[model samples]
Target: MIHRPRRLRTTPAMRALVREGALTPANLIYPMFVREGISEPTPISAMPGQYQHTLESLADAAREAVEAGVGGLMLFGIPAHTDPTGSQATSPDGILNRGLRVLREAVGDRAVIIADLCLDEFTSHGHCGVLDSEGRVDNDATLPIYAEMAVQQAKAGAHMLGLSGMMDGQVAACRAALDAAGHTDVAILSYAAKYASGFYGPFREAVDSQLKGDRRAYQMDPANRAEAMIEVELDLAEGADVVMVKPASHYLDVVADVSAQIAAPVAAYQVSGEYSMLEAAAANGWIQRERLIAESLTSIHRAGARMIATYWAVEAARMLRNSL
Candidate 1:
């Protein structure tokens, strides 16, 4: 009774002073979708308040996020064309690289610009890699494609590449490619523990994914935890500057474990499904929108994510700044 735990909770000032985790604009990375032919920002129905932007509109969005004090912007492109080899992905004129160029012009070193380094959005088969004659994702073949992609994105002015393909040896391949191309300054943010989760449903729509089958062949299984550490270690050894775990809420344990074991900065993605669920519930009057948004992000931060990729980054950044 003498050591009353409620003493710190007695006042807002006291609570702030003893707060263990702080969620701020500096911790957020906004994930943006850029469509090839769109003239305006097209609203994503599933992810309320989010949009797939045109190059012009995406530049404005990047400006807004930077102005709002968000730490970074992550770009995902929806190309105008798709092919068997995802040839457009390595093209300099491809949607993603174009978007990155636009953002670089708009922000001009104001914030970190990250390109999602994956082929799912550009491939006719909607897989993360090139297919073999037998019709399966060719892991070894995918590494070279990713290496080329890293160089292309770096040339496009991306500050970092979000390597989300889950291909083995991708980090080493990309690192080598980048260094050889004289893009050693561009960082690699490896999706070290990305799991094959249902939480990516809305994201497929966001990127216009043509996936005909599951990515379980490449993405990690959701049931495993220890494997996450191994993935982190491998990516780090292969030259990953940052490591990430996807679907932050569901795999906080993995996030914490990775953060604890690694010297590199750890990131967690609050994927599209997580945003949609809360938005849907809020629209139905089931939850407080602002509070849930803050809570969800704070929980991810508290769970040891040094940076978070979220759909709500700009709004959350504004809110955090206002609170301060």
Candidate 2:
């Protein structure tokens, strides 16, 4: 009884002082969607409060994120055109590249601008890579495209590339391309342990992904935890500056495992479905929205994620700042 844990819970100050994990704006990386040929920002219905921003509005959003003291911004593009090879992804004028340029011009080193280096948003088939004669995702054929995309993104002022396609040897391919282009300074943030999970449902809508089939062939299987470590090690060996685990809430074990095994900075993506579920619960009056958001982020941090990519980054950052 003398060891009463109630002593620490007696006061807010005591609780604050004894807090084991801290969630701050510095730990956040906001994910943004940019669309081509739009005059204004358009709300994503499935993921309420998230938008597919036009160029001008994207600049505004970037500035707002920077002002919120968020650590980084990640961009995904919805292009006006789509093709089998996702050729637009490697174009400097591509929506994602353009968004990166806009953010670079607006934020001006205030926040790290990350480009999502994947083709699912641009490919007509909605696959992450090019298809073979058999209509399967040709892993080797995808490397050159990713290589070109990396250089294009680097040239567009992306401070880091989020290699989210989950292809084999993608990290090495991108690294080689970047270094060859004299973009050795641009870092690669590899989605080292991305799973082909049902949790990605909302994201497909957010990006207007036209995928006819599942990405299981390329993306990691959800049931295997040890496979995540192998993926992380492969990414590290290929020069990934940061390694990330996607749909973070369900994969904290993977996040913690990767964090323990690697020297590279660990990132966890609190993906679209994770965001939508919280929003849905809040709308139904089932949970305290603000508290849940903060707690969710705290849990990820406690699980050893050094950086978090979340739709609620700006709002969570503001809440954290206000709490202080």
Collision count for each candidate, in order: 0, 0
Whole-model lDDT, model 2: 0.93
Q: Compose the digit string of candidate 2's lDDT tens values, residues 70-186.
A: 999999999999999998998888888888889999998899999999989999999999999999999999999999999999999999999999999999999999999999999
| Each model's lDDT | 0.94, 0.93
Give the candidate number with the greatest lDDT.
1
Residue pairs in candidate 1 whose N, alpha carbon or C atoms collide under 3 angstroms? none
Q: How high is the lDDT of residue 252 in model 2?
A: 93
**Residue 169 of candidate 2: its Cα lDDT?**
98
Candidate 1 global TM-score:
0.99
Which candidate ranks first by TM-score, i.e. highest? 1
**How far is 209's C-alpha from truth in model 2 (Å)?**
1.0
Candidate 1 C-alpha lDDT tens digits along 1-324: 789999989988899999998888989999999999877899988888889999888988899899999999999999999998899999999989998999999998989999999999999999999999999999998888999999999999999999999999999999999999999899999999999999999988888889988999889999999999999999999999999999899999999999888778999999989999999999999999999999999999998999999999999999999988
